[model samples]
Target: MAPTKKKAEKKGKIQEFCRKYLTVDFVKSLIFSPDKLSFLTYFILFAELALNILIVVKVKYTEIDWIAYMQECEGFLNGTLDYSQLKGDTGPLVYPSFFLYIYSLLYFVTSRGSNVKLAQYIFIAIYLLQLWLVLRLYSKTRKIPPYVIILSVFTSYRVHSIYSLRLFNDPVAILFFYIALNLFMDRKWTVGSIMFSLAVGIKMNILLFAPAILMLYITSLGYINTIIQLSICAAVQLIIGAPFLMTYPVEYIKGSFDLGRIFEHKWTVNYRFLDREMFENRMFHLGLLVLHIILIIIVAKPCYLFFKNYARLRTLQAQFEPQIAAENREIEDLVRKKMRKATKKADEEEITPEQKKFMDSFEKGMKNQFGDKQQMPQTKEEEDPQKIEIHFDQCVQLALLPIFLINFIGVVCSRSLHYQFYIWYFHSLPYLSWFTEYHTSFKILILFSIEFCWNQYPSTNFSSILLHACHLILLFGIIRKIYKEIGLARQVIKKEN
Candidate 1:
C-alpha cells in the first residue's frame, strides 16, 4: 500500500510538470500562431487546384469555352476581322483584340494531336501562376488579414470556379492587377506602373483602378514621387496603346469602347435584385455612375481627414515627455554606476557590467522623455472616433456599404458583364469590405457562405433570382449602416446632444 501511494504521488508530480510544460495547451499555442495562417492558405489553395482539376476531367473538353476559343483562333489565322465569327450571332468576341492575338498564336503553334488538352493545360498553368502572384501580393500587404485574401478569392459572388475554368481574359488581368498592387505596395513604382499598363493591355477596365492607385501612392510617397510614378504608368500605357491607335485606331476604339452600346437579351446572376431588364436602358448606366461617384467621395473624404488627424496625433506623441520621477531615478542611478565603472575601467582597461548597464539605461532614457516607458502606450488621442465605432456593432454595416454601392452602380451599369465579369466583383469585394470595417472572422464567414451557395446551389428557375434578392437585402442593410455612420444620422445626433 505504501509503495502504491508513493508511485501515485510521483505520477501526479509528473503530470503537473507536463501541465506546466509539455501539455496539449502548449502544443495548441504553437499551432495557432501567425505561421498557421500561412499553412492554412497553402492548404486551401491546393485543395482548390485539386477540385478544379477534377472538374476539368469530369466535363468534356470540347463542351467548354475552349472550343469557342479554338474557333476564334481559326478566324484570326484566316485574317478575319472578328475571331468569334464561328459562333455567328450565338457567341461573341467580347474580349479585346490582343486577347485573341496571343491565344490564337498559341493555338496555331500547338494545334496537333492532343492539342485540345494542351490548350486547356496552358490555361491551367496560367491559373496556377496567377494564383501564386495573388498569394504573393497578399503576403506583401501584411496590413490585410489572410482571411480577407481567402474570402476575396473564394466567396466573391462573381468569381465562380466554373467561370474561372472557362477560357477568359479576366484571369490574366487579375494576375496583372495583383502584381501591380504588390509592387506598388513594396515601393517599386516603375515596376508596378509597367505591370498596371500591361493589365490595361489585357482589359481596358483596369483603368478604373487609377484613382485608387493615385490615392495609394499619394499616401505612401507624397506628391513628387506620385507624379514620377504616374508619369511612368502613363508612358507604359502609351507605348502599348500607340501602335493600335496608329494602325487600326477607329476599329480599336469602336470595338473596345462602343461594342456594348446596345444590350443583348441575357439574364445575369444579379438580375433578381431588380427587374430582369434593368440593364437594357442607358439610364441605369448613368444612375450607377452617379452613385459610384457619391460613394467614392464620401469614403475618400473621411478617410483623408482621419488619416491627417492620426498623423498629427503621432507627431504629438513623439514630442510629449513623461513626468514620472520614479522613472528618472533609475536613469540617475545608472549614470552614477557608469561614472564609477568608467574610473574602474580606466585602471583595468576593460568595460564592466556596470558600464553596459549605464549605456543601455542612457539609450532607453534618450528614447523616452523623463525616463518613462520606452514604448508608446495606447491612448485616447491616438485613437480615432470612426475606428472605434467600426470595431463593435458597426462592423457589418461597414462590410455592406461598398458592396451595395459598387454592385448597384458600377457593376449593374457597366458596358457589359459576361460570366467573366464575376471576377471583378469577387476580387474587389473583400477590399470593399475593408472600407466597411467588419470583423475579420465575420467577413470570412459571410463570404464563405455566399461563395458556397454560388458554387453548389442548384441554379433552378427562380433560385438564382431569390439568392440575388437576398443579396440585395443584405446590401440594403449595409447601406443603412453607412448612412448611420457617415450620413444624416450623425447630424441628428449632433443636434440632439
Candidate 2:
C-alpha cells in the first residue's frame, strides 16, 4: 500500500509538470517573453512589405534621378572609365566608381533603365533591405520601444515616396550604412569597417557618419586598430576607383569626390529661409562645415569621457587585481572550511533526520547560488563585477549613442538637404527621440512637423525654419539624456578597503 501511494504521488507530479509546460498558453508565454519587441519588429516589417507593394501598385513612379542614373550607367557601360566623361541628365558622375558598377547592373537589368516600374520594384527591395537592417539594429538595444520603429519606417510619406517612387541612389548607401552598423554592434569590427567603407564609396554623404564610426573604432578597437580601419576605408575607396584612377586620376579625383561641390538652392529643404546667394555661398558652406565639425566634437564629449573612464577603470582594476584575487581566494577558503566542518560534524555524530534534511537543503541552495558564480571572469569586458560597474551591453549602448548623436549633428548643420536626403536621418530620429527628455506628445509633434517639411512639394521658408527648430530641440534632449544616463566623467572609482 505504501509503495502504491508513493508511485501514485510521483505519477501525479509528472502529469502536472507536463500539463504546465506542454500547454499552448505556456508556449505562447515563452515566445512572448523578452523578445516580444523583436516579434513586433518582424510583424511591422511584413506590414511594411505590404505597404511598399501597395505603394508601387497604386502610386506613379516619378522620374527624378532615375533617368540621370540610367544615363550615367549608359556612359559607364560604353567603357568610359574617366568619371569626368560620365555625364548624366542631372550632372557628371560625381559619385564614386561603385555607383557606376551598381547602376550599370541596374541599367542592364531593367532594359537599360527603360523599365521604370521594374526599377521601382527593385528600389522597393532595396528600401526594405535598409529598413530591415535598421529594425534589427534597433532590436539589439534593450530599452528602445517597438513603436519608435513605426516612426522610423512607417510615418514618413516622403521616405516611402523617395524609396518606392523616385528610386534614388541614397537608399543604397543608407542600406549599406545600416548593414555596417549592425555588423559593428555584433562586434565584427573588421567586416563592419569594410561595409562602412563600401557605404561611403556609394555616396560621399555617407561620410557624415565617419566621425561617430571612427570614434567607435577608437573606443572599441583602440587607436592603432582605429587607424588601421581608417586605412581599410581609404583602401576600399581607392580599390573601387582603381580603373578611373588609372585612366584620368585627376578627373576621377575632382569629379567623383569633390567636397566643395555646390548645392542647388532650388532643391534645398532645410535652408529656404536663407537667400539663394547665402544658401549657395562657398564661404557659407565652409562655415557650415566648420560648425559641423565643432558640433560633432561637442556632442562627442561623452564618448571621450567614456574612453577616459574606461582607461581609468582598467588602471584601477589592475592596481586592485591582486587584492580582488586574494579576497576571492579567502572567500573560497572560508566556504571550504565551513563545508569541511559541517561534514566532519555530521560524520562524528548520528545526525537527526531534521538536521540531515536541513543540511541537504542548505547545500543545494548554496550550490544554486554560488556554484556558477565562483569562476573568475577571463574576458577583459568585466573581470570583476564588484569592481567594473559597466557591463558589455552597456559599453555597446555607449558606443551607439555618440554615433547617432554625431550623425544628427551633421543633419542639423547640413549645408543643404533635399527631400531624398530625409532617409539619411529619418530612421535615427526615433532612436534619438526616445533618448530625449521630452514628453511623448512633443516628440510626436516635432516628428510630424519634420515629416510635413519633407513631404511638402517645394520646401518653404517656414518649414525649413521649423525643421531646424525641431532638430535643435531634439538634439538638446538627447544630449541631456546622455549626460544624465552616462555621467562617466563624474564617475569616481571607489577603492575597497
Candidate 3:
C-alpha cells in the first residue's frame, strides 16, 4: 500500500510537469505565432522541395502544353514574328510576349524543349520559389492562422501536379504575381508594378488582381503617383510586347488578350454541369460578366467603408491606445530578428529564449483589424519609448486584403477553370476562409470540398455543383464580414454622436 501511494504521487508530479510544459496554449504558441511562422515556412518549403524532387524523379512527366509552347517559341526563334501565323499542336499562341520569351529560353535550356527531366527540375525550382514568395506574403501579414498553411500547401494534390507533374505556364506567371505581391508589401510600388505588368504579359488571368491593385495604387500613391504607376505598368507591357505589337498589332491584341475565346466544353472544370450549348452560349458568358460587375459594385461600398473605418481605427489607436504601440514593438522585434537571421551565419546566430509574453498577447494585436475595437483618445499623445514599426495589420490591409479579396471574387466568377488554374487562388483559400464568418470546421470543410472537387478529372456534375456551392458560401461569408464591419462602425459613430 505504501509503495502504490508513492508511485501514484510520482505520477501526479509527472502530470503536473506535463500540464505546465505541454499545455494547449504552448502548442498554439509554438505553431501560430508570427515569430514562429518563419520556422514553419522553412519546414514546409523543405518538405515540399523533397516531394517535388521525388515526384519529378518517380512520376512520369505528363506532356500537356509543353510541346505546343515549345513549337510556338521555335517559330519565334525562327524569326516568324507574326502572331497570326505562328501555330502549334494545340492551337495558335494565345499568351502574350513574356510567355514567348520564357518558353523560348526554356526551349534552349532544355535542349530545344526535348529534355523533359531538366525542364521538370527547372519548374520544380520555380514552384518552390513561388511557394516561398507566397509564404512571405502570408508571413508579412501573419493574418491567417499558421495551421491554415497546411490547407494551402499540403492538401492540394492538384497544386503539386500543376507545378511538378505537368509544367504549366500558369506557375511561371503566378510566380511573378507572388513576387510582385511581396514587393507591394515592401512598399516598392514602382518595381512591383513592373513585375505585375510582366506577370500580365505572361498570362491575362493575372488581371483578376488588377482592380484591387488599382484601388491600392490610387489610395496609397495619390493621383499623380497613381498615373505614373499605371504608366509604368503599361510601359512594361508595351516594351515586352513591342516585337509582336509593332508588326502585328491587331493579331497581338485579338489573340493574346482575347477575352471572348470559347474553351471546349470537355475541358471545363468549374462549369462541367453546363451542357456544351449552354457553356458556349454568348448570352451565358455575358450574364456571368454582368453578374461579376454587379458583385464587384456591391463589394465596392463595403471596401470603402472598411477603409474609412480603418482610417478612424488607426487614428484612435495611435492616439488613445498604448496597445498598438506595444504591438508595433512586438512586430518590430520579429522584423529585427528576421533581419539578423537573414544575415547571420549559423555560428554567429544567437539562441533566444521563448517569447511567451508576446505569445500571450497575440490575439490582442488584431484588435483594430476588425471594426469593434475603437476607443476615444484620452486627448494625450502616445509616448512611445521605441520607434513604432509599421503595423503588419496595416501592410496587410493596404496590399493583401483587398487585392486577395478581389482576385478571389474573380476566381469564383470565372467561367472556366482548368486544373492548372487551381494555383491562381490556392494560397488565398485560407485568407478567404479566415476573413469570412464561417466556423472553423466549416471553413476547413469548404476548403477541402473545393480541393476534392478540383481533384476530380473530367469534373463530374456533382463536383461542379459542390465547387460552385463552396464558392458561393465563401462569397457570402466575405460579404457578411464587410457588412458586419460597417455595422460595427455605425454603432460606434452613433455612440459618439
Candidate 4:
C-alpha cells in the first residue's frame, strides 16, 4: 500500500507538470514577453541563416531544379529566348520573362553564370526579406500573438529547404504575394494589383488567390474601381509576357500555361496512389474536375452571404447617413465637453507637482483608451459616412475563406504537388489560424499535419490527404463562425431599429 501510494503520488506530480508546462498559455507567456519574443525572433533568424549557409557549403549539389535554373540562366545570358533550346533535365522553363530577366541579372553578377554560391546568397537575402514582409503584414493591424510567430518560424522548415536546397522561384513569388497583401490591407488597390500580377508572372499558382482579391475589390471599392484594378492586373501581365510572346510564341505558351504538359505520377508529392498511366487517363482528369466543381459549389453559398451582407451594410449606411452624422456630432461634442471639464479642473486645482503628474498620467491613459477627442471630424464627409459599422475583421475572415477553400481543392485535385507547391497555402495558415481562433490542440494538430506532409521526401498519400482535409475543415469552421457572427450582427441591427 505504501509503495502504491508513492507511485500514485509520482504519477500525479508528472501529470501536473505536463499540464503546466505543455499549455499554450504558458508557452505564450514565456516566449511572448516583448523582450523575450524579440530575442527569440532574432535567434531563429540567425540560426536559419547559419543552417542555410552550412547546407550550401556542405551539400554543394542537389538533384533538383537549381541545376536547371542555372542552365536556363546561362541560356538567357547567351541571348536564347526559346525555353525549348534551353530545356534541361527539369524540363523547359515555364516562368515568365520577368523571372528569366531577374535570373539573367543574377547570372551576370555571378561572374557570367559561374558561381552558384553567390546566387544562393542572393536567394538567402530574398528569403530573409520574405520573412520580414510576413512579420510586417501580421503585425500591421494588431499585435501578433506569440504562438502565431512561433508557428510561422517553426512550421516553415520545408520552405527554408526549398529556398536553400532546391533554390526554387516559389519564394520570390511568395515575397511578392506578401507585399501585395500588405499593400491591399493598407488600401493601395492599384499598386497592390500590380504586385499581385507580378507574382502571377512568376508562377501561375498564385492565381489561387484571385477569387478573394476580386471579391475584396468589388465589395470595398465598387464595380468601377474593381474593373480598373483588373485592367491594371491584365496590363501588367501583358507587359511581363510580351517579350516571350513576341520571340518564341509557341514554346513560351506551351511552357508557361499548358496544364496537360507531361508530369510523371512518381514525381508527385501528393496523389501518390495514382500511377503514371492512371494520371494520364482522361477519366482521372475528369474526376479531378468534378471534385473542384463540388468544392466550388460548397463555397458558393457563404461567398454569396458575404457579399450580400456587404451590400446590405452599404444600403444601411446610405439610408441612415443623416442619423449617423448626427450621432457622430453628438459623440464629438460629448468628448470635447469632458476634455474641457478635465482641463478646467486640473487648472483650478492647487496641488503639489507629484499630484499634478499623477493626474496628468491618469488623463493620458484615458485619452489613449478613448482616442484623442480633438481628432474627431467636424464635417459630414470628413466623418466618413461610407465606413460600415460591421465587424471588419470578421468580413476579412469571410473574404479569405473561399480563397483558402479553392487552394484546398487545388491541393486535393493536384496530379503533381511538388515541394514548391506548398508555398501556395502554407504561409496563409498562420493568418487563417489567427482568424479562426480554434482550440489550441486543433491548431497544433493542423500545423503538425501540414509540416509533416510538406517535409516528406516522397510525400505519403495518407499524410497529404490528411493535410488537405485538415485545411478544408479549418476553412469550413472559419466560414461557419463568420456566418454566425454576421447573423448576430443582423439581429443586433434589427433590435436597434
Which one is best on lDDT?
A: 3
Worst 10 residues of 1 by lDDT: 387-396
Give one digit per residue, the lDDT tens place, for model 4 in 15-92: 999998788977777565432344355566676688778777877545577667767878867788776786656777
List per-candidate RMSD values in Å.
Answer: 13.3, 10.5, 13.5, 13.9
Candidate 3: how large is its RMSD?
13.5
lDDT of 2 by residue, 1-497 (tens): 24545797799999999998888976665343423456676678789889999999987777879899999889887898887888878888788888888888999999998898888889888887887777676665655655556655677889899889988889998888888988887767778888888888888888888877876677667889889988988899889989888889999989878988888989999999999888878888889889888877666777666554544544455577677678778767776777687667755775667887998898788778899566545766422223323223333445566777788888898889989899888888877787787897888787888888888779898988888988989988887777775654355433321
TM per candidate comes to 0.61, 0.76, 0.80, 0.71
Tens-digit lDDT track of model 3 for 1-497: 24545797799999999997678986787566654566688888889889888888888778899999999999999998888888899999999999999999999999998999998889889988988887777776666667778655877889989988888999999999998988876668999999999999999999999888877676666679989999999999899999888988999898899999999888888999989999999999998899889888888776655544444554555574577667777878877776666556532542333554565455456564644566445776444346555553444553466677788889888888899999889888887788888788899898899999999998999999999999998989888887887788789999999
lDDT of 1 by residue, 53-164 (tens): 7656776653445666666656656756532242422365555555555666767767622365555556666666666765554343233455556546654433534333
Give candidate 3 misplaced runs (Cα > 4 Å). Answer: 1-25, 32-35, 305-395
Compared with the true structure, all predictions reach lDDT values of 0.55, 0.78, 0.82, 0.70
Q: Total backbone clashes of model 2?
A: 0
Kindly state the number of residue pairs that clash in model 4. Answer: 0
Candidate 4, pairs of clashing residues: none
Top TM-score hit:
3
Error of 3 at 83 (Å): 0.6
Error of 2 at 48 (Å): 0.7
Clashes of each: 1, 0, 0, 0
Which wins on lDDT, candidate 2 or candidate 3? 3
Q: Model 1 lDDT vs. the true structure?
A: 0.55
